[model samples]
Each structure stands twice: as C-alpha cells, then as structure tokens.
Target: MRNASDLPPEAAEASASGVERRARWLLVLLAGLLVASAAYLLYARGVFEPTQTLVLVADDAEGVSVGMDLTFSGFPIGRVRRIELGGDGYARILVDVARRDAHWLRESSVFTMERGLVGGTRLRAYTGVLEGPLLPDGAQRQVLRGDALADLPRMVNAARELLEQLKAMTDPDAPLNASLREVRQLLQKANGRDGVLGVLMGNEADRTRVTAALDDVRRLLQRLQGVADRADALVQRTDQRVFGAQGLADDVQASAREARDLLVGLRATLQRVDGVLAEVHGIAVNTRSATQDLDALRVEVEATLRRVDGMILDIQRRWPFSRDAEVKLP
Candidate 1:
C-alpha cells in the first residue's frame, strides 16, 4: 500500500518489484496461451473424440513419425501416435483413427509404404473390398514395404550379365562369325546353277546320287498308288458280285422259295409227330406207375438180402471158418 516513489533507493535501483510483477503477468499469459493451443491441437488431431487404435507392424520405421498424417484415398483420416519396438523385433506403429474415418478401414484393408527412387516415401492404405467387415479396435496388421532402391542392385547385375552375353555373341571373332561365313557360303551356292541341292550335297557326284534316290522314291510312290487303285477296283468288283441287286438278291429269292417249300413239308411232318407224341405221353403215364411199383419191390428185396446176410453170418460163426476162406453153400 506504500506510494511508488517512497520505495528504498536500493530496491528502486534494482527494479525488483516491477520485474517480478511483469514476470508474473507474462507467465500467466504464457500458461493461458499454452492451454488454448493444446486444446486446439487436440481437436485438430481428433483426440477429443472417440477413436479406435490400430497397430501396424513393419520391418523398418524409416520415414514415419508421431503425429504424422495417415491418408485414405488422398484424404487425411488418422494420425500416428506412438512407435515401439515389439518383442518379435518389429516396429509397432500405433495409430488413432477417428470413429467417422474408421469405416474406411476394413478387415481386408492393406497398409504399405512405397518408397520412390527420387522422391519421399509414401504410406498408403488400400481397402480392396468396401463391403467387408469394419476393422476392430486394437487390430494388428502387417504393413508391406516396397523400395525401388532395394531392387536396383539386382536389376543392374542382371542387365550387366545380359549386356556381356550380347557383347560376346556380337564379337567379330566369336563362333557366330563362323556361322555367318557358312551362311554366306550357302547363299553363294544358292546363286549357282546347282542351287540349294549343290550346297547341301557338296558336289555333283553326291547330288547325282541324291537325285537317283529321289527318282527311285518317286517310282515306288507311283507303284504304291497304282496298287492302291487296283485294290479299290477289286473291292468294288467283289461288292458287285456279292451284294449287288442282280447278284445276291437273285440267290436270296431262290433260297427263300426253297425255305417256303421246306416249311410246308415241315408242317406235314409235325402233324405225324404230334400223333406219335400223344402215344408217347400215354406210355409215359404207364411207365410212371411201373416205376413206383419197382421202387417198392426194390425195398422188399433189400430187406430180404439183409436177413440172408444175418443168417450167413450166424452160420459162419458156428462153423468157425478161417478168415480168408469163402464157405460154399450145401
């Protein structure tokens, strides 16, 4: 409550109170601004709203950072929150996707980081099927990595090998040169009067031999064709003799008439056979009755034989005949 000018000289010289007051106001203002800025950043990052967390595991986290934007179809939808090394030696990137944008990520979605040869790397999200189920919270997915720089070495090696092979093949002193010389010789031979045949056979004597062989083959082919023609003519003649209208038909008609007469004779014979069969049936009935009587007689005879056998055994036992001797009946 003291006046401003009534302060001590030493305190005035130091200007301690004024400096302390200014510092307090400045701190308060800074604190307020920091809070406001944090709130704005949280809103911008979609942290104030509900979100789902997704983890993307990658072999290398090269160009990614926290709070980096995650774009979907060229639209920003999420941001990376944290990156940690998992126990399995992979980097796990935690991303917070807003609820509204979460629908864009399905279970079938794939994440990839495509690195260009001359430009910055890109983090792309690919949802192959829009009708698939939505990705659940805390989903762990593997991120595919593509690097143009990584494949350059292998491509260069393969190209270098291909170029070396081409160089060897095109060399003037290579085996290909010998083949070219042979081709030139063949072309020159083709322009000669002997033509390609002379080039292949190498001389007139060999060419004459080949020509003779060809003539023999032509003659053989002509003979074969003539034989085939004669065989076809013979087949036609056989068909005319065996199955033509005037040939087999006439024989068939004659045979049919003979068969008709035979059938008429067979009918008359069948009448006589029917009378004989009637007599045979009557005899068969009588034979059946006689067979029954013979069966009864056979049974009686068997019984009599058994009785006689017993009497013979008794007689033999009373006489005490030798085992090998056959007794004669008195």
Candidate 2:
C-alpha cells in the first residue's frame, strides 16, 4: 500500500468527488424536508382546499380585526380575511369558510360582532333552521354589533343633568330654599311657650292673653265647684231640719193631734149641755106644780151656766184662737 501522502492523483480526485456527492445529497435532503414541512402547514391551514366567501357589513369595526374567527356554537367555522370601509360609510368584513364548514352558513344565518370585558372581539354566526337553503358564494350580509361600553356616556350625561337640577333647586335664592326658610320660622314660632297659638296669633301679647284667659277659666271652675259644695251642704241641713225626728215636721204633727183631741172634748161637753136644756123644757111643759122644782132648777141652771163660763175661760187659756169670748143664746 502507498502512504496517504503518496496516494495517486486519480484516487485522491475520486475520494474528493465522493465527498462532494455526499454533501450535495445532504443539501438536497434538507431542502426536500423544508418544502414538505411548508406544504403540510399550508394544507393544515386549508390553503389548498376550496372555500366560500362571505361579506359582513357593520356601522363600526372598533374591535373587529382581520383573521378573527367566525364561530358557531363555540367552534370556528370561518375567519375574517379583510376589513374595509365601504362607499356607504360602513365597515365591511370579508370572511372565508372552508367548503366542509360552509354548510353551517345558511340563507337565514345571522352574524354579529361582540366585544367582551375579558378578551378581544369575536365574530359569531347563528342559523335558526338547518333545513333552509345554503348560503350562496360571495354573499354580503349585515352584521349586528353589541358593545357593552357604548351606553356609558349617555347614562353618565343623564345623571349629570339630574345632579345639576338638584343643585339648582337647592340654591339660596331658589323657591325650595325660600320655602324652607319660611318653614323654619314657622317651626320656631310653634316651639314658643304658647306652641301653635304663637304661630297662629303672630304676637306674644296675644298668646299671653290667651294663656291668661285659660287660667281665669280654670279658677272660675274651682270657684263654681266650691259654691256647689256649699249648696249641697245647705240642702242636706234643710232636709234634716224638715223631716228628721223631733224636727219641724214632728212639732207640727204633735200640734195637729192635740188640736183634734181638744175639738172632740169640746163637742162632747156641748152635747151634755144641750141634753140638760131639753130636760128643763120638758119639765116646764108637763106640770104647773113643778114651780118650786123650776126655781131650784133655775139655781142649778145658773150654776151650770157659771161652769160653762169657766170652761170658756179655760178654752181661751188653752187654745186662745179668738179674743172675743161671746156665747150667743139662740
């Protein structure tokens, strides 16, 4: 064998040619691998597949961006490829859907763009009926927008206007403030010693007069009560004097009983005297020989008359009704 440094020129050239060929083969393999990887990524992205185009129109595309996915039931069915301002001063969003997912877009499908508090804007599609016809190619549809932050300015403006109105009403020269001052004055008057009377009368002197009148009425009522008590006591004493035991009623009753007994005794005595007179008349009519008896009878008769006179004197002393003691003979 020849030494390596002593190798033939043809052998060295052959070895160099082999190395060049291996290096070229390695370069070609790497290039082929890079192309395959790029093709596979494109195929995965659906660049090679057929698709349907849809155009969405909106008033504003504030958060909507290109390449945003259009979803149905949380699954991505299409992507936003472009956004442009239309001639009618509206935003237009272009979308492309793979042919396999294009059936999810129907003729009556609805599309919307919603911005949330947590994430970027989202595009959504809704189909109410699956039995409807499929959406056509390059169809233009209206997009509805729901922005949570949109209504804040109008609500804030309304609240600010309400606050301004409240401030105006509460100012020092406002009607409400004037009314409050008047009410405060009324309350102060009502809190006086005469209370509501002071507020109504508008003068302290008048309130004092009213208080004095009330005091006089109360004193008058006390005086009346004292007079009533005295009257009641007087009436009770009068009743005791008129109707109680050994009172005026008893004295009058005793006097009436005594007078009746006296009248009855006088009547009996007068009857006896009348009987005696009748006997004397009968004797005078029967016998003229009875003259002596008549004379004796005259003496007895005089005695009886004297006794009747003494009885009259006793009656005048006992009863004393009349001063004239005349006894008429009939």
The CA lDDT of each predicted structure is 0.90, 0.90
* Per-residue lDDT value at 136 in model 2: 97
Q: What is the C-alpha RMSD of each candidate to the true structure, in Å?
A: 22.2, 20.4
Instruction: Rate residue 232 of model 2 by lDDT.
Output: 100
Ten-residue segment with the worst summed lDDT in candidate 2?
Answer: 320-329
Q: Model 2: per-residue lDDT, tens digit, 1-330?
A: 776568889988888899999999999999999999999998987789888899999999988888789999999988888999999999999998989999988999999889765688889999999999999999999998877667778889999999999999999999999999999989987886768988887888998999899999999999999999999999999889989877899999999999999999989988998998899888868776867678999999999999988987777667656667554446
Error of 1 at 104 (Å): 4.6
lDDT of 1 at 82: 98
| Whole-structure CA lDDT of model 2 | 0.90
TM-score, predicted candidate 2 vs. hidden true structure: 0.46
lDDT of 1 by residue, 273-311 (tens): 999999999999879978989999999999999998888
